[model samples]
Target chain A: MELWYSEMHTEDVKFSIRIKEQLLADKSQFQQIDVFESNEFGRFFTLDGLIMVTEKDEFIYHDMIVHVPMATNPNIKNVLVIGAGDGGTVRELSRYKSIEKIDVVEIDKLVVDVCLEYFPNTSVGFKDPRVELFYEDGLKFVRNKGSKYDLIIVDSTDPFGPGEGLFTKEFYGNCYKALTEDGILVNQHESPYYSSYAKSMQRAHKRINEFFPIARVYQAHIPTYPSGHWLFGFASKKYDPLEFDSKKWNELGLKTRYYNTNLHTACFALPNYVIDFLEESKND
Target chain B: MELWYSEMHTEDVKFSIRIKEQLLADKSQFQQIDVFESNEFGRFFTLDGLIMVTEKDEFIYHDMIVHVPMATNPNIKNVLVIGAGDGGTVRELSRYKSIEKIDVVEIDKLVVDVCLEYFPNTSVGFKDPRVELFYEDGLKFVRNKGSKYDLIIVDSTDPFGPGEGLFTKEFYGNCYKALTEDGILVNQHESPYYSSYAKSMQRAHKRINEFFPIARVYQAHIPTYPSGHWLFGFASKKYDPLEFDSKKWNELGLKTRYYNTNLHTACFALPNYVIDFLEESKND
Candidate 1:
């Protein structure tokens, strides 16, 4: 059988590639992970019907999703990542020396097992003493958690099917409550190019803004994601990601493939459509 | 007939939608140009086999391509755009008061004619007195041109059919010659994600850098374009787009969907893969 790895950018759009071999398959964790060498799209990795990585452009998605919010809040010592089962986000987040605790809440245990087995590099930080793995529903985890975090990063899948609740205003509200006073929260907002998710993003921003004093939508270029352009939502109680000390971020000396202090500020400078949505929501 | 619009991010990957009707079709130019109201990907427009503008999200591509170079050189008075048949680039460029003359070289008369008919908003700038339309090959125009331009923007199609030459080193060298001493040249480099056209881009950069003092590649979030992330090449003799006067650009009062002074500087920050290519080429 010709194995192919496909990523659903949306229910209507997907990108697929022929694969050389299935690297690992763990049915117990509800994840069948595979690493395949491909002629195009570089080294392809997939888990639970989702594309985890491609050799040609993994850093763009991994670094932007992790580092932007981390850099935004310099005092972020405790971080929580929801649904980054593949551990790519954790690997990137581990680079920060100040991060004393990195908690990963993934619903699927298979994804973690497969990632550790085949995609070792992405899962390298999973075994670190600073990291804690939680096999629980992301929405429930945020709802029930008593401990406040300095930074919470939602590196979940698309806001459809298993990931539907991830996009709800309720989850965002819970996230707002779960963070410390100066806490910052970042979530993977879907492609504004294709779905009604932009409205969902706007709605989430509205709800989060009601709780937190600051909420902003930023963009990153992720080719495999639907529409190739993906938006990330940042909500903070007091700190603005844009007003960071650049000299300090430079001193941290994170050898990044993408994210820097210059980019950290620029990513927040959203396009007019996004700005208009925020403005329109205020009037409503 | 139910017309379906598909944006093939690559030959292997596509995102499509069914349309209610074909809004306009003009066969006067070298390629057939058509616009349609589509259920997915929004208002769809096509030139030949290439997707041009979809009502939903074209500003990402248009603004990044136009404003990056314009921001780099604030004193730009005369601008030349090559192969922007839709006139989206012109609409963006025309916003600046410093831009006195805007010349557009498009080989396909059909694209311009159809754009004027169907995509009137994008084509609106063509009626501006400062605009000059040349229905000729961009390469041919650059070779024969005597006058120099402060900025040259290549807003051509992909490097497949008619646009094949636009991606070549010869075309870039000619673009170098067509600009004034302080002139800057910007072209839509293909996606660093899917298209290994980075080699071609690197080659062009090498050839152009030999003549021009500085050349660099910047990125934009263009979901419709191949790989969802797009790269733009900037080559200049004197001006750096990053060190421009933001106060003046703010005064230009260019109502843009995406480009701002912050983004202008941020676009130049490259990923390690892109930087590696530039460095590799430098060593060679």
Candidate 2:
């Protein structure tokens, strides 16, 4: 018998993988979590049936999300990660030896537990000395924590279910208040392809633009995601991602699979249509 | 009951679209052609069950394929397009009033006929007076031709079945022979994320590097394709795509949805993993 797991990218589009075995299916307080093993993508876990990470392409996500912000400000000693319950975001952050403290706030303890049991490579950071895990709502954690973190990375899910609060204007305002003067706020910015995701992305970009002096979006090619094209939001008070000194970034000599000094600038070069669409979206 | 069309990105990974209706299905002399309408991608057609163009995102493919080479050499007056039966490539090329002629060679006539009927936005260039449609094998057409075209575009399908010859060393050699001294060659280089497509991309790049003095690959976000991250090859005898005078391209003032001056340079700044993979492929 053949078993396949499919997720609808849109109402009309679906992506499926042939599954060898179903590893686990548990309903957490927040959402439905399922883990499965597949020949193509290795082991993958989903939150509410939406692919969160796969052993195959998680590196691309981790490398892009963590490194883009870190490389922008090499002095980012205090790091805060929100909703990265799978531990992949913290895994990449822990690689930077200069980082002194790493705090992760996850609303779901079950996700961290499930990933720790199945995805060892990504969940490895949970045991790192510099890493501290907090099982709580990310939106509430940063409410009054002013200027604590040099980098705040919101490694969130979609703009629905438990993840929806993380995309609110109030959440972004809190993130702004929680950041140091040079702090960089990076969040999951959905995608620009499908309308469902694009709306979320546009909404997030607009909200973030209101709270930060510098706001931009960058892209990565992650095949496990809905469209295989995913985006990340970078908002800052002073440092623009494009203006970061490449010489300093290269000096760090961080060995990354996807993120590099050259790609730092390249990622921000939005397509002309996207530039126009984003500009026009401000009026709406 | 809802109907769907699925394409195997790999043996174990599949991408499917819910079909509002199957617009057309027939077997031509070379391959099977299918067309479907979906709310997500609008009207899309597949050749041998693989998506060729969609009303929604065909601009990304056509813009990246045609304009990248055009901007590199604005003096390009004559062009040869291989297997672009959809005529989208021709549509983009025809916009350049400086161009004197366009020759499109397609092995399958039914693909063109189908697209002309369904995809008017792309197929509009077929009605241009400058377009000369050739119902012939691209390999055979350019075999002995020497310095005939300022540009050659191999907008063929996957490196299999009808499109097999387009990826062969012999075919690239023929394309090299058929180009003017400052000639540029662009082709769909496939995606680097999936191993099947990556192998084809690696093989094509290596073969082209053997013949051309300058060879590089660029990327685009084409969601309907295998990985949504698709690549295109740029090869030239005299003009390097990067060193091309950008001031000249901007003067032409071509309004585009995807391609622009910034992306012209940014597209070539590929991920480190892709760069390493492409380089390692040289010895493969």
Supply fnat for every model shown: 0.56, 0.89
TM-score of chain A of 2: 0.98
Give stretches of model 2 more than 4 Å off. none
Weakest ten-residue segment in model 2 chain A by summed lDDT: A273-282
By lDDT, the best candidate is 2
Query: TM-score (0 to 1) for chain A, all models?
Result: 0.88, 0.98
Positional deviation of residue B7's Cα in model 2 after best superposition, in angstroms: 1.2
User: Which candidate number maximizes TM-score?
Assistant: 2
On residues A27-99, what C-alpha lDDT tens digit does candidate 1 reach at each position? 5534455667766665666655666576656778888888777776777888889998877889888888888
User: For candidate 2, lDDT tens digit of each residue in B163-212?
Assistant: 99999999999899999998899999999988889999999999999999
Per-candidate TM-scores read 0.86, 0.98
C-alpha lDDT of residue B89 in model 2: 93
B1-284, model 1: which lDDT tens digit per residue? 64556655455555565667878776653566777876656666776746778766677778898887776677789889999888888988888777899999999887877778767778887988899999888888889465479899988877766777787777877887788888888888776665456665666566666767787778887766666667888888888777788887788777877777777777787666677777776666
lDDT for each candidate structure: 0.76, 0.91
Model 1 pairs whose backbones collide: A29-A110, B29-B110, B72-B241
